[model samples]
Target: MFDLDRWLEIFQTINKNKLRTLLAGFTVTLGILIFTVLFGMGNGLKNTFYTFFQDDAQNTIFIYPGFATKPFKGFKENRRIEFKNEDLALLEEKFGDRIEFTTARISKGTTVKYKSEYGNYTVRAVHPEHQYLEKTIIDRGRFINENDIEKDTRVATIGRLVEKDLFGNENAVGKYFTLNKIVYRVVGVFSDEGGDREERNIYTPVSTTQLIYKNTDKIDQINLSYDMAIGANGARRLSRDIKKVLKDKHNIAPSDRNGIYVESVIEDLEQNLQLANVLQIIVFWIGLGTLFAGVIGISNIMVYIVKERTKELGIRKALGAKPSTVIGMILQETMVITMIFGYIGLLIGNFVLNSMGNKLEDWFITNPNVSQGTIIFATVILILSGLIAGYIPARRAARVKPIVALRDE
Candidate 1:
């Protein structure tokens, strides 16, 4: 089935018409290149969305105290709402089954000193379950435990950066650090995917912080992760129920939305995810449109090429060449050009993306890439476009009378 003569002739024609062939090839190449890069950047944007939320658990919810705007039950408007250790207990007692992990947060910034090295860092007061809530990974030793909370022990779990700052190359476990002139032994060294900022804090027992700082049971915020089995709707219902309970318990007005701010991570996550999906769809269409433009460009070029070779085609037909042979020649040439240029475009696009690395992270494009399936599909589309583009003009040329085509200027 392989015709060496016909293929050699096709090559000879391509060789003789370098400028025209280059122009056709350029159109195809440019189209696929643009499509590849655009789709890759779209994927990069989606990656940014996911990476942004990776620092915290997706099922987590944060409850921050806010001032009441309306008066109720002798309580005045503008009253500051404060969460206590009892609030955490109340949630556990009420929604024990619905909750997975709960923690009361007390954040304080203080200068930490170990030996000759020292740095100012935040001290996060938390329960053992805070590890899951913050996605903390213990690299050495252990996180804060129940006994540490119960005993109000003067101990802390230091962040990786904190250890680096205060201890240099020395391991921080079992070491002592001074915070506010009070000595606390480090029990663990931890890391976070949240980068350097998150890894610069020190974690201690909530009870210990309450006793040392203000000598009260006051907490800054409440954070918890719900059981994943409780779907998004269930999380919303639970959020509403929590707000109502906290409102009624604090004697705030029923309609007071500002008194208790319950933020559901899943809600924001779902919305952003929807946005990411929409962007991808838009990108896909944009890429498809670019590809269509290339197909059109090549189609036009094929028509022009046939017009230029009209007399030559007529002579071949007069010399006993079949109409199918004429069609085949044009189709074969188009295919060869399209395939070579399309593959070149794909390679160049991928190389550009790879070379970018994380340099475009500021633009929310991380590791932009097109999948193998997409590459194959695009290649197939280009080949088919070539066939169709060449077929139309080739068929018109074949249908012309030898005398009429010969008379063409």
Candidate 2:
């Protein structure tokens, strides 16, 4: 029941000891403030990691040839391993069902020119699957397609940076630019989340690049993936099977680890996920530690308050006050302090984080905010704090004898 008298009595007590209540409230506020800030920062770190991996499929794998460090199948050590387009074709033919996507790539540092402007840029010959692999964003025109590769067309998809420097603000689609003294028309303007280095490359069909560079059928690397939806374990298994088959084909001994290098994007993603979980646990532990300190302080103050109010409680008990009523009164005061303090802390935290939004802009962190669940959880914790802190003190007050409490100084 809503007791007006009880409410007025509670307010009277708070009004009588304003400074003491304020000091106790400050401790709770500080604890929640630290908690809110730590979680906000944790969220930022997680955002940074996700943004870094946004450019590629979570399940993607990259294969690069490496020099033989140990002799395999009686072959001499230090022999260089190279991949050819046939390797890709063979893999596709064999694992066509399991293989979801694939790309073969070779890069070169070349001078790109458009009349009076020229700049150092990377030229990459890639298959149609390369666009999806790189998470490419096309601003204009179209990316390299199967027809371009089959016909070996003298057409290129240039990065936004390439378009910017070579052609200024002019439309780059259908314009011609010379790469290594050979003219190729720009067919698309593309960009990626991979930042400036990735933006300095020009993409073209693999067949054309192989023919123009006089390195027919040669490729530097291959990217393959099973599926992102199936997650890391499935992707790992697929990659292992693919690697075993490639090892057998390349005359690489089963024990030779240096003959072919396999880098798993799935592994990186799994590691990031584990790290994010660990970070949340650590942040909450630290925050809870700080908050619990305030809880202890509140417990101590309630103890002191009980000692001071002993005589009054004894008189009330003599006048027919119930033990539960005494307990509820003490709990109500602690709850009020916690609610006010925690709310102020929550409000301050959100205001600060929101105000700093502009300054915190970048790939590192985005849209850091405390969720409603967090606020609700904090309030729950506050209610628990009130019950816990006031329990023993309320019990002691309930046990007071009228004669003894009245006799106390």
Candidate 3:
């Protein structure tokens, strides 16, 4: 039960010691505030990592050709490496089981005109599989099909911003657009998570670009998605094997680094995620440290409060108060102060985080927030700290003799 008289006396004691009570509450409030903010910021940092990687498929890999730095077989040093349609077919044939999809990329910059509107935009000549590799979402129509690639059709898929820039609010699908004075029909209108830059580019059949740009089979890059079932270590091995195969085919020395570059998205993502996890762990420990400091502060303050009330506690015990009752009274007072101040800290911390919004995006912190489970856990800790802080001093006071306490100054 509720002990109205006992609570009244507790309030009177607190009323007489305003400074002491405020000090104890301030310690708890400050601790929880710092803890909440630090933990939320850690979560924000993690969000940044995910957001950055989400623009591309996590299991994807990119291959780029570079000038060979070492001579091998009949090939001389400083030979420029180039990937072609044949390379894409070779990977599909050699590593078909490990590869999910592959595409050859040929990038060019051209002025696009739609009626009276025109803009300078990038053009990506790619196979049908490039849609998946680039995570292109077809909004108004279908992406490039096998039929388009087979006939080297002059059909194009335009990005969201491309439609907006050159076609205004008009739907781009089934419309005609000119790239470098060559007309191509827009078969699809698409969007990308890669922001405005990606959404400003146009995609066309790799065969059409190869024929129109240079009348050759040259490609600038190769992109592929590896089977996710391969796991991280397997992905690394696959990348190494790919480099070896391509190097051998191109007659480049095995030790030459400039001949080929293979980038595994999963490998970089794993490393970055590990780093984020470590950072969260560090923030957790720091939050716990702050709570620990608050506990110690409250403990010291409880000891002082008990010392000041030594004579009063002795009188209550002389009047036949039980040890548990004395302990409960001190505990009730401690809990009231801790509960009020700790909750205030939680509210203020959450308010600060909410107000931050995207202001911290420049620092790579996005939507920092603490889960309800964390809040509940912290609340429990706060209550227990109060109990522990009160219990030790209350027990010591209850044990002191009435005569001994009354004689003290």
Candidate 4:
């Protein structure tokens, strides 16, 4: 099906109108470049949302205590709704099957000292199961154990940044660090891939912290993990039930909206899913629009070329050239220009995105990339563009007759 003569004719025609060819090629390349990068940006935005999900389990829910904004049962407004250590235990007992892991947390910024090197870092008192709630990467030794809580032993697991600040190049594990002047043995050094900012926290057993920091039986928040079988709908129902249970226990009104602050990771994940879907649809439409613009430009150029070469086309027809031959020449030229330039644009966009890697503009954009499937899609669009641009003009070329060509000035 390959015709060398048709290809030669296309090349000769394009060479004679270099500027015209360049303009047509520019339209195709520019459209493809914009479309490709839009795809990359949409991917980057999805990654930005994923970074938050990485901080905890996909099914984790966080419960932070807040004051009652409305009163109930002879109580006035603005009553404080604080969580006690007993509240978390009671919830676990009541919803053991629905919940997989649960932990109470109390955190504050305090001075930590190791051999005269001191820094202010956020110290968190958490149960042993707290490790499962956060993306805790234990770099050395172990996290707080049940033994630490049972005996109320003073033990610490410091973040990587805290370790670097307090004991650089020296092993922190098996050593002692004083927090608020109370010496606690360092059991582990941990970090988050979210970088040094998230790695500045130090964790200890909740029981020990209550004794040392005078938190007593009070807990600031509760972290919970659940099975995926209790999906987003189940999770929402559980969240509402938990809030109602706590409100009733605290004697807050049934309608008191500010009695507690309960958040579900399931809800956040669902919202993210919706946002990503919308972004994909918008990118698809915009890319199609740009591609159409390129097709229009190529179609316009082909029509002008057919008009300009009417005399030549007529002479070829008079000399017994077939109609298919005339159509083949025009189609070959359009396809050559579109395919070559569109591929170049795709390659350049991929190069720019690949060069960016993990770090890019702000934390908003990370690892922007186009998949092989998306590239295949763009190629299919190019082939259609070639067909559309050449069709009408090639048909007109085929219809040219010797008398009409002799008449055309």
Displacement of residue 383 (Cα, Å) in model 2 is 1.5
C-alpha RMSD by candidate, in order: 2.3, 2.2, 2.7, 2.1
Compared with the true structure, what per-residue lDDT tens digits does model 4 show for residues 1-409? 3877777777888899999998888888888888888788788878877875788888898998787888678888898888999889888987788999899999888999999799899999999999988879899999999999999999999899998999998999999989989989999999886677779999999999888766489999999988889888889988988888888788888777788888988688779968986987799789779978988998898899889989888888889889998887788888999998889889888887888777765857768888899999999999888888998999988988878986788
**In candidate 3, what are the lDDT values of residues 1-409, reduced to their tens digit?**
2889978987898888899989998989989999999999998998888888887898899999999999889889999999988998999999999999999998889999989999899999988988888889999888888899889999999999999888887888899989999999999999999888899989999989888876899999999999999998999999999999999999999999999999988888888889988999899899989977887898899999999989888888888988888888988888888888899999999999899887999999989999999999999999998888888988898788888888878
The lDDT leader among the candidates is 1
Residue 244, model 3: Cα distance from true site in angstroms: 2.6
Models 1 onward score TM values of: 0.92, 0.93, 0.90, 0.93
Rank by lDDT, descending?
A: 1, 3, 4, 2
Q: Would you list the C-alpha lDDT of every candidate in the order shown?
A: 0.91, 0.84, 0.90, 0.87
Candidate 2 lDDT over residue span 1-409, tens digit each: 2789888988899899998888878888888888887777667767767777878876678998887777778788888888998899888998777768899998889999999999999998899889888888999999999999899999999999989898998999999989989999999999988988788889999999888776578899998767556666766777777778788788777777888888887688669868986987899899888888888888888898899988888888889889888888988888888788888888887887787663665645555667789878977997798679888888888788878888777
Better of 3 and 4 by TM-score: 4
Which pairs of residues have clashing backbones in candidate 1? none
Q: What ranges in model 2 sit over 4 Å off?
A: 228-231, 358-366
Q: State model 2's lDDT.
A: 0.84
lDDT of 2 at 55: 80
